[model samples]
Target: MKRGVVLLGAALLLGGMGQAQTGSAGSKVPLATGTGGAVATVDLDASRAAMRILEAGGNAVDAAVAAAATLGVTEPFSCGIGGGGFMVIYLAKENRVVTIDHRETAPASFTPTVFIENGQPIPFDQRVTSGLSAGVPGTVRGWQEALSRYGTLSLRRVLTPAIVTARYGFVVDQNFRNQVQENEARFRAFTSTASLYLPNGQPPAVGRRINNPDLARTYETIARQGAAGFYTGEIAQAIAATVNNPPVAEGTTLNVRRGNMTLADLANYEARLRPPVVSTYRGYTIYGMQPPSSGGLTIAEALNIMEGYDLSAMSEPEAYQKYLEASRLAFADRGAYMADPEYTDVPRNGLLSREFAAERRALIGSQAAPGSVPPGDPFKFQTDPSYPLRPAPAGFEGNDTTHLTVSDRDGNIVAYTFTIESIGGNGMVVPGHGFLLNNELTDFDPVAPHPNVPEAGKRPRSSMSPTIVFREGKPVMALGSPGGSTIITTVLQTLFDVIDRKRTLAEAFTVPRFSQRNAATTGVDLGGENTPLAQGLAGLGYRWAPTPEIGRLTAIQFNPDGTVTAAAEPRRAGGGSALVQSGR
Candidate 1:
């Protein structure tokens, strides 16, 4: 009875949580402003799902889980329980920042030579569709542990929105349809996958409702039985069986490989709590995920190097040159050093040290450095090597990922980025689970002596950068994105825009992004390769390549007047959704 009263009062606190929906499919607002709390995601339904939790007395952790689960339903192609991810959380009461590493792990049977046959490596795409590409999923355990550790809500409560979203379904948009169309051939190869996504033997039309009753049931069982429901029960058996003996339809010409996943691998899966990577740039404190994921360390190192230059004092093009140079140097170090920490000794603190940044920044000349550069030794920068080596790992050449940001009135914040690794995730849905398994294992380099090569029970190195920024002991903003290795560059550029360039959140999102990652040619997105900026940079010996898109970033900022600003992309991935408590 007491709980009921609390619920009623909480529900009435904000009359707009449910009524905040401004429109249906294509009319979502990219930037939202309000007083209490806020949520931002790539999908409108997901933002509303998180907002509902906030309106019902849930904190940022609760709302984030709710948002993530909702994304699992709506942004199914990008992320799901069948994949893995990274989570960074700010516990307001404790005033501490922490991270969860739920990245997918290689099966115990995995070896460095797993992807190598004869003297050559198997084609990467062939491995992707095979069960061998799937890693032991970690999203479910990450969610369960997060709720248990810092949330006022239960797993069952947080999962309610996702179950509802999956059961009744949501509106299909152009992006969803396009993704299906893109993976048409892959879908046709698996009957279970084709049955769910291609109901009429074709992609569903845009604006139509697509329901996943199987996924809803999957969620319901997990809600009742906890992580064990998926990791150790009947579902676990089903997952292993599907991976070991793919349910490919007869007459499918594609030769799919088998995985060595076992029921014990599922039963033993665990999400770990890792210390957050902390760095300071021009007085603002930044917190991000540690290695096994290189997003945090790489961003910190680049920003630390950029801090040497007074960007605000330079011309736009000059600043960009320095930005590109800083990114290049940082990525050189990332490619050479980063990997799963439990597998190798990482030179973490040295990579992020002020001295190392100064040394690396010194390498940037008046002209762009040619091609890929060698990594600098950061060991001398460390006073005591207090940090685990946390250099950014080389990102896989894939970009299908999703991010969400949430902040509560009480100051708690969550920045989460997750993925199924590649579009449509190896193109094999669980036999009856209605979710695609991740192709995360393909993230391995497969080269001999490579730190990121596959190893028994090793987590794949990732570039999912979930970041939180603090000003004078209080969290002022949170952000993250999904674009494999480019994720680090994307977040760093946006952070530079917001903190250094003094651009509004919306304006920052509009800037044409240039991503340089220690490559001979930098990738440009939201702008063509023939832009004036590109032409001008060509004089400096910088080369350019046009990438379709870079990243889909979501962020929330705490304003001085107590209002929160939630921002998303307006033109990418059919735009995104940003919502606040009441807009009052």
Candidate 2:
């Protein structure tokens, strides 16, 4: 398979054009493209892996699965077979958008107070690193279901690159090295983790090659035997055993409550097919993942509220204020109402209703709200009276996930976001499996008697926003990001940049970002802090802080002339590539 060059500098090198200047930020992003197919991911290897499948005549879903599997091998800290996620796909033949909810589910023995002891909640670090935080993983089933349902390639064919990479190993880049250094102490605590990442009793240096034969075998088994290979065999036993009986480091006391996950839990897990949440903004239809993910509804609500304002006409400062206000209002409702739909009645219709957004829009004044805006009564607009209007509770989310977008010549598109929760999730490898388990259970509110509290067989709420945009019933864009709770705001701002400000795909991603998630102060990226927008916001009596990074957005845009453009986030050390056909 032939690959396009990924240029890194202020200028982007297109196929015909020598060097095209990007936005004001002077980004180093390589906006890859192809008339036949395009794939964008945070890792170059993963993007290339997907492109290989596309070159082999597989559709977008097949290429997406290949990319996702390759990412598990290369970027294991973010996501792997042990984690779960959401996928939003657009099928060209069917001319329809669909969503699959593979979010992790809590064990049947779980209770609202599972993370609580005596009358107080456990320390976050303790709970986050404990085996008790492991949820029933659904990523394997998700990959299998996607391939079986929509893909033309066999599982073995799609997973070859990942298996080979895991066996032969790849050089550790600066990003991979940095993550290992940051978590070196925690990695040292676990024998399995330490052995894989910490070579010679130290974190591997940049450019050092690392291999994981154990993970290679695991993937190879799944490829041959299908999802059952991981969910109902030795691999499943290893996952359950590690959770039920956690390993403790010498001279360190682990304050953890063990999980009661049996083999049955793994076998019973299933990825549900659901309808994608739909909304309209300036004649373009936006589709996103539904329940178990707060991203879709929250983004829709924010967009609805912002629709009342003319963002393109407003100055940067003025527009940012409205964006922040809308985000706060949407987050307020997200905290109170968004959860697993099967476990609780989420006011889905009312939350996304334009009428309800109008009511919330009235709350935004010339200045920001005094403090955290209270959640609105969306239940009043819906028929579900059982949906309680509860006060929002405080929770924590981490920016440890990866997102990918793929588009094929046939017009099929896939936008996927997956995570293992926090970095080096739970700090425990499933014995010899070589993949970290997710702490997704911690996404639930630790406090008892709350809407997002953990429940038996209940999926945890997520902020992974995999979105697709369509114009006149044809998909024009597919995008998503990974920033924990900030994912919604990042995606929303990008949408405004492209749709409202009329910026190119590169400009939309390169622009400075600001996020306010119902917090006392809004977080401004490094560039935003030095701009007049920051000063104007401060003068408006708003507190602002600097964030090193907000989110890593990977996007693919389809042009009216049948061309494809793909861009990856330049803020991080990631790249993208496209596959061109012989003709066209």
Candidate 3:
């Protein structure tokens, strides 16, 4: 690893560009309630930045974009311009919900067998550190489109907070340090990555300031030149070079494969505008992103199944069992049907239909599936319900992503989830651009004859479920999270908690979680292995292992008393931040 890095020089270089931000470095609040506006995120700086935007008269979309950009700096390992995500927006004035699908797209050179050779797939972990794992990023384009379409501020105006955060920097905390330590070996393989993240050949000390003037300059260019600065000129070329021919250390032992990305792919990228899927459960209408993301469909189907039962009438443990069973049933269909809409004909209507959910619900008996259940048949589609599933070729997705929720005084709301697909993605930073590349392409299935297999310019299916709930034509809640696939279950369970069990938002988030994603054994992040719930579930044919943690969720609720409440994970991601424009 490199030694004696000078992160301090960045502070000196950017000192004259603008005044550094104040009152955000130590702004950590896990829950806040008030009126006018609200913001919740997994980072102090990010949440504070959004709150500042709201205070400046920006709308929810503008504040959300501001928060997203700041997360690219403070939560660098999880997200940045190198990645892409889905944004769900509720426009109260228009009385409708719209979604932006900026999910990453594979290069034109990609093919179904890109990850396969000689009838075998590349080792998942080996591919994670290579150039072959990145996709054409869509975040910058997504941000530009959002601002042009619905935002009240310019890109330059909204990006000021992120630019300042990058220039002046934020203090490194334990979570940030722990993430670096976990990726140290891979980070050391690339000179550019190691030089910035691994100061003194180790994770930067907790409470130490780390600045990135290069990133600040990059943001400035995009601010001044709009998306063109990122997609058509120097920045785009740098990204392509970094992905096609990685900048590894001189004597590295890693076998990083070259990628297929090019300038054309970057220039041609578009953040497609999609209509949000609408589903109702217990009299509330839920809005979520459409296909190219299974989150909406899976969660809607699970909620439909859940609606079939009186979860409110059951004991806590009984409700947990039904939730697990519903999760498994939903994941079965997800594994079998969910994929990029452009390439795969996803059964949108059938998947979300109450009839389909009822059919699938019947298969869930008094006991869980003996091992794993197969996908059930949906209406208007002819297929055998018992078709054998292809065994998984590789498991490579990381539970690494960041979610932010924002709502303004006028009632506009946004729930955004973006990610680089893994912590310290690709473990290689663009030489001077000062950002990590995403391993998002690793989310694609490795083989052919599968809905999720890679295809030229095809966006990989994502599990990001940014959701907003509306009751009587007005938004009641907005929420999302950053676990890989467990994201679906996380959002589902929380929705059930508040709507069915009458739990407070804070109580819903604090409770232990049991995520069953159609797996033979449910992953238990519910406190511990020896918990009473765990012991009691064993008798019902349930098997589980400890997952340590599940997901860090951020949510905002529009209350009946004309006030708003923002809540974040109190114990996840070193505790999250929830800040309102004014205190209650």
What is the lDDT for 336 in model 3? 81
Candidate ranking (lDDT, best to worst): 1, 3, 2
Per-residue lDDT of candidate 3, residues 1-584 (tens digit): 00111233233223321111232234576788878788899997787677767766799999999899989998899999999999998888998888999989999999988998778989888778888889988899999999999999988878887888887888999999999999988999999999999988889999999988788888888988999999999999999999998988888888889997989999999999998989999999999989888899999999999899999998777777888899888888888888888887777777787788888878777666766677776645433232333433323468999899999989899999999999988888988888999999999988777788889999988899999998888789999999898788889989999999899999999777778887788877846557787777777788886786788999999899998889999987688998777665
Estimate, for each residue in 137-227, the C-alpha lDDT of model 1 and write its tens digit: 9999999999999999888777777777777788899999999999999989998999999988889999899989889889888988999
Predicted structure 1, TM vs. truth: 0.95
Best by lDDT: 1
Candidate 2, residues 30-121, lDDT tens digits: the string is 57555777777887667767767776688999999989988998899999999999999889899998888898999888988888888888
- Candidate scoring better on lDDT of 1 and 3: 1
Alpha-carbon lDDT, every model: 0.86, 0.83, 0.85
* Model 2 collision count: 0
Model 3: how far is 163 from its true place, Å? 0.7
- The parts of candidate 1 lying over 4 Å away from their true place are 1-26, 383-395
Per-candidate clash tally: 5, 0, 0
Candidate 3 Cα misplacement greater than 4 A, ranges: 1-27, 379-396
Q: Which scores greater on TM-score, model 1 or model 3?
A: 1
Give the TM-scores of the predictions, in the order they appear. 0.95, 0.93, 0.94
